[model samples]
Target chain A: MTIYLPIAELSVNIFVILGMGAAVGFLSGMFGVGGGFLITPLLIFYNVPPVVAVATGANQVVASSVSGAISHFRRGTLDIKLGLMLLAGGLAGATVGIWIFSFLRRLGQLDLVISLLYVIFLGFVGGLMLIESINAIRKTRKGVVPVKAPGQHPWIHRLPFKMRFKKSKIYLSVIPVIGIGFGIGVLTSVMGVGGGFIMVPAMIYLLRVPTNVVVGTSLFQIIFTTAYTTVVQAATNYSVDIVLAFILMVAGVVGAQYGVRVGQKLRGEQLRALLALLVLAVGIRLALQLVITPADVYSLAIGGVHG
Target chain B: MKRALLATLTLLGLVAASPAPAFAQALSPPAQGSVVERLEIGMNTSQIAITPDFAGADLAIFGAVVNADELLNSIGQYDIVVTLEGPKDFATVRRKERVFGIWINRHSVTFKEAPMSYTLSSTRKIEGEPGVPPLDAPGIGIQHIDLTPTDFLRGGRLLEDFRDAYRRLKMESGLYQPDPGGVRFISSTLFQANLKLPANIPSGTHTVRAALFKSGKFIMEKTLPLRVVKTGLEQAITDAAHQQPLLYGMASVFLALLTGWGASVLFRRD
Candidate 1:
């Protein structure tokens, strides 16, 4: 039957959007990340405007992250101290990201830059992680003693302004933490992403936060940042439509739960490898678009008035 | 020869069998000897300079109103319509006429003006006071005008605004129902309805009829034949906007960073 979709301004199968939400949710739930990399492209494929997709996706991220965060908290896997620090950095980063977005928009080249960065970052990071994880898994299978604790790099000790992390048992400079925040912020704004994938890894490797805390801290930051992003984009940009966000969020919460469960079953090395590979694949695809002359190119501006 | 004759006769018979209203119920033929009086379609500023690039296209007519003094004075709710008669292109997918009536203000209540002429008649160009006639373009084509931005305005067109709000609320709450065809129509507070073109739309001049109805009666009728040329770049832009906003947004960001990395570096240095 022909159903009129308010968003598409056409009659469509009612299940198309709902099913999309569910599918993305299941995958995201099956995996321990926001399914944005999938959802945004899927929406784009359906010809949803990029602005709406990003804004709506941000809205969905909040819901999914909240659900995931709560579950992790229940498991006592969340490192509240580290999560707070990351949140501080994430918020600062988000504000800066917003400013950068506005400035780039004025120059009229935001889309090209965002795609290029995504392809580059996701591809490189994903490739490295996948390779490393595969090796770790292979070594573990071979009965090699898996490292009991993360290695203490000498540089982390020499960095000025060392502070003790009681839970992580590592003291590190605040500068790197702030820098990490700033970097994640820039990435989030540019790519319209939550920066969770970036955050989790950085927390674990750079800041020496425990692995259990990484996902929780990232989720903590994402919830706040994305929620703020939604309101700002909505009230100022008139881009956020709560209805669209709510629908996706409901599906995402269920998806995230399943994803986390599946994630728990796999060894850390294998999961990292898979995630890293996925990132690399998306990154490479995005990078190619930049190097290649696009089959079609277009530009647009806000046509509708904002409230 | 016999088969060909039979085919022609069969075609004639099929045409004859089509439904026709009884004589008394039939629509009256247009008035006789009516002076053309400088025919022009009312349109929004956006629709001006519309160029059609496709064969057999339909153009939008908007911001039109009938200037009957008697109708103006006795309005609790009144419908204003414009009709396009004579030549037209393409078939109507769906059509609805919009009538916006704002209350006259104290200062303009006593002001009297002559029947508006077709010259400078489009609503956007209306040089009138802040009253009902001036508030809404007296006659608006429901199928042509975009009401989104206007609806977003704080005090623009209240009735349409209210309707849109209601629709949003209903849809969000999951109270809205889809029709049997799976198309759920939330009432539009916006001005335009996109008319879909059939794939096999025939080219040529055809009669275009438009009327405004209030309480199921035609209030005004306007007929103007327009040549169907090609559809404009509007659809393409719309499609692109919907299909790839992130790609567009991200690309914009990438260019900024290329330039902004220097700025970021400079700020860091500072």
Candidate 2:
């Protein structure tokens, strides 16, 4: 059956949207990633307006993050204090990001900027993940346990505004933590992603947060950042389609439960390798689109006349 | 302007004075010697309510041609063309250029006012026939439609290219459809046609025009007004989003938070 989306002003098959939501949700649950990076592109492929897709994708991320965060909270793995600090930075970054988005939109360069950002960020993150996972897998096969370094680098130690995070049992300068949060916030606002992929690694490598708490903390901050983005996009751009978001979130929530169960049976390196492949695959597809000539060189867009 | 106003008033007075039966008879072709032909048209529905489940709509236009000359009727040369045009809106077309190995929008042209969607159906092929009136003769096909560029870009050398691009893109999106032989005649005087509206048809007031031609020459034309509007939940949501965007945005955020919190609560494990 087909249903018309009000804000997007398009008719889409119910089953197709549901399936898309479930599939992305499952990956998000298993990998502890926001999946907006996946959903936004898929929506674009399905011909949803780019603005609507990004806004609605951010709305969906809020639901999945909440669902994932609750479980981690119950397990006592969340760093609430750290998450709040990161959220403060993220909010400020999102504001600046939205301003930039508006300026780019006025200049009719939003689509190009968004596509280029996706290609660059996805390529970098996906490439790094693929290499690390492959190396970890090779080490396991050779019967060698990987060792982690504990001490902070000189630059990180020298930063001002140091604070202690009790849950992760770490003392770190707030400057870098806020900077990371700000970067993720900008990405979340522009790309409609939860930025967990970047956040998890930053927390692990830079801040030396406990691996077990990283996912929870990232999710905790993501829920707020995405929520803010959703509201801002809706108010300023009027692009958020609540019905589309609702359908995706409902299916995503259920799929996430199943994903968590399945994740328990998989080895860490194997899961990471699989996720790395998925990320790289998406990144390559985006890169190829940039290089290949489009079927129609000319495109039409509705003028920016606010209703 | 005064003369036009007087003419319109006189026409309205004639309509008001005529009875229902007289009005019907008045539309018939003029007696024997007159070269004029009379056309009467009706639509299945004048207003289309777009609900949440609305995929698309098929519009049926039925009409009759009265007093077509014997020469035209015998030769099977009478043609009927029906067109439906949506409200005009500003549109922008952009061409992408390869810059630094990445495609970026380089050139753009903006149309001041263009139909958001247009559908045309004709009894016979609109083009490629000798002596047949061109589709854009006056009030016929899309070619005849007046598309003006924005004031700043008017009279530019590249105007034709931009117009062609706009038409091409609209066609690709199924917003502009021109189907030949779409209208069929049941008998000499009576004809009907169906216009298929795409799922993405914009909501607005549309004008439907039916024109009659004899021996490849335009004779008479009639226009009907139509309304395509969103109804029910779809209407409500769109209105809120556009009219009260701030409140709508806040509600959307609140709803998301509530849904997330509710899901967590429901699925929480002790």
Candidate 3:
């Protein structure tokens, strides 16, 4: 039994925390998920203040992305221009998301709203990816060129200011790209996440960005958004514990390197399936909280005795 | 003549038994009491003086445990309560009741004046000088023996003001200021009592007594017979901090990096 001290009450055993960190860090590195989904729930289970846990988990995303970004940079997979464009949109979206969060919270419906959003988004995205991946595998086995559904929305094509994405081999209007970025940012701010999982799929399927650039750009956006979150929380709320940040950063970095190596051996379809499954599991958990009668009521303690 | 002789004999007996009552009474530790002992001296005494002395603040008296064998091996505890008497110069003086050494799962500081339980940590001649260290750091320091309630003073408001003043003094003294360290100990486990003088406080000797109480009773008491001079000693700690701001800042950053990096390395699998 590990006896956690004052701050550690919500902190698991160092070994366990490290293990969890490593797992989350690895997944984040390979698939570009922020790992907030895993870290926040675990912290809540350990009895950390819900708000603090969310903010702190977001802070660690910055570190997680740093390690993955380095690997992608080294592999010549980074797309700086694309990354910057997404970041610009992400910042604007994040500000909007925060505003929406406060508004919902004031209305006493934040939890319900966020939970509904998670289930809808995750189920839709996961199902879509599963089907697309299966189709890709089938086409590959038959030695046939895979057919993709054409994005025939006239407005998406006719919007003003068409721009070139050399790496993605597409010239499309910048409005949709910026809109996607802003929408992801809003979700990121509300959920206290890096928005990588959402951004990756959007870039690959919707924006038609190349796979190589998707992961790198998603991580790039994560880095900037998380950094912005850190500053905002620190200055306004004093919620960022540099100490806590450092601990998670260390674990996340090492996990990143390992994830990259393992990711290299795995097939892309398999990795995507695993990512989808993970997101689905989290989505189900969030949805259950709404309909299920809680097993306990009149909670006993404000803080747990030694996490 | 017979009547006169009888009256004279009665008068002689009264004088003979006067000292018996005084000798029979001995202060004993209560069933669940505790004791704490500190030495006290005159207010004008030097910070380095190592001799025992008597001191009074607002006439608040304190006593030290010169001979406490009766409390040495008792079954019940002898929690100690130290109080400063006389001048109410500091806010801690009002909370004279809260100052004490406590046992586990005990009630708040006892209010009764019964003998309390105690364990002797040390005994020494309390030195008053320019460089005396803080008493709560768990070390053997100055010692004096007195039983006065007004000798020491502390309060929450006072502590806050003292901290602010200390920070300003450090700044003025060319000392560095950074993040104040985290509170590692909780209230029941440990507490601090610091005395501060208002600007109008007399610039002369001040007497303070540290008293020990256990289970609501006074057990062992000690007096800090030191003086409040024109110079400030608490400022020294602030100055040291301000003088090394870089060291403090780097320490904070290093701590962050170490924990962050360590978490990364420890969690990484080959």
Candidate 4:
């Protein structure tokens, strides 16, 4: 069946959209990621306008992150103070990101910029995760316990305005926390992601936050940032497709439930390796589109999207 | 008395061939040696209310030639061209070039007040006949539709390229459609023009123009206004997005929250 997306102003196969949502939701659930990184690119590949895809991607992230946040809240793994600090930064970054998005749109360069950013971030993150996971697998086979060396603070610790996060048992600068939050917030709006993939690693490696609290705190911040981005994108760009988002959210939540059960059976390093490969594949596909010669160089835009 | 009679004949001849902006027009096969031509055009429906299942619509417009020369009409020397022009707005056409190993939109040209969609239909070909020249009016056919550039109109032939690209893209996308033989004569003086309205046709006040040409020379023209409005679910969503954007945004967020919250509750871990 074909369903019309009111904001995208296009009719797409309902099954295709549902399958995409379900697939992405399953992966996010298995890996404990928000899945916005996957959904936006998938929607773009399906011929949804980038504007609508990005805006609606953020909206979809809200639903995908909600259950995870609630689970963490019940377990007391979430750090409310840290999440709030990140929220302050994220909200500001989203505002800036929206302005930048509109500016690139008018310049007719939004598509190129979006593709480039995705390729760069996805490639870097995927590469790092793959190498890290492979080494972890090797260590497991050798029967060596993987341990993190503590009491080592990098130059980031010297920054002023430091505050103690009792839940994470760390004293970190608010500036870096806000800065990371701001970056994630910007990505939420521009790329239509919850920034969880980036945030999870950043907290563990950079801030040295405990692994137990990282996923929960990241989810907490992502929920608000993506939700804020969705509302703002709807108000300003008017690009959010409620029909498309709803369908995706429904399929995603259901898929995640099944994914979480399967995830429990898989080993951690193997799961990370699999996710790394998937992310790399998506990045490479986007990179190829950037360098490939277009069938037609000239494009017509009448009243934005031609009749 | 003989000179006075000669003067009256000359005045009558001038009136027959003179431009008749006031004359109503239709789209049928035009005939040569016109004595006098007056065109009147009307549509089957005044407005098209697009329902949710609207794929597209083929509109039939009826027009007639009043006071047409009988001999010329019989000879098929007349051609009728009917065009449907959608709401106008400034449009931008962009061209991509490979820049530093990446394809990027490098150049852009803006057209001044171009119609969002253009549908043309005519009896015979609008650009018909080997010896006979095409219609002189610029607004008569798809190719002749005005697409004057807003800027970057240097003496180079580049402007022509941009204009051609714009039209070709529009045609390829079904925005600018043309049917060479869509107009047919139901009777000796009455003709009907069939215009194919694409599903993505802009909703607003559109203008349907019917121009009459006798022996490839413009005789008269007529215009009618058409309204295309979206109805049902599509209309409500579109209106809410544009008119009440803030509320629409809030509602969208609320929906997301509800969906997320509802899912978590339904599959709660007991």
Best by lDDT: 2
Among these predicted structures, which one has the highest TM-score? 2
Docking class of 2: acceptable
Candidate 4, superposed: residue stretches over 4 Å from native:
A3-5, A27-49, A71-82, A95-121, A149-175, A186-194, A208-216, A259-265, A304-307, B1-35, B129-133, B152-155
Clashes counted in candidate 1 amount to 55
User: On residues B1-270, what C-alpha lDDT tens digit does candidate 4 reach at each position?
Assistant: 453344345434545655564332322233244235689899999898776555678899999987666545787867799999999988878888998999887888888889989999988677767965666666677777788777744426877778889999888878799898899999988999999997667778999999988777788899999998777787788889888877887787788677767766787854
- 2 or 3: which has the higher DockQ? 2
Q: What is the interface RMSD of each candidate, in Å?
A: 20.5, 2.9, 17.5, 3.7
By lDDT, is 1 or 3 better?
3
Cα lDDT tens digits, model 2, B22-139, are 6434333333433466799999999988877889999999999865554446567678899999898888887878989887678877776788899999987777477655543374
Q: Residues B80-137, candidate 1: write the lDDT tens digits.
A: 2332222211111111121132111111001011111111112121222355232133
Better-scoring candidate (lDDT), 2 or 3? 2
Quality class of the docking in candidate 3, CAPRI style: incorrect
Model 2 gets an lDDT of 0.77
Show the lowest summed lDDT stretch of 10 residues, model 2 chain B: B24-33
10 residues in a row with least lDDT, candidate 2 chain A: A256-265
Best-fitting candidate, scored by DockQ? 2
Residues B3-42, candidate 3: write the lDDT tens digits: 3454344333433534454422223232222222333322
lDDT of each: 0.47, 0.77, 0.50, 0.76
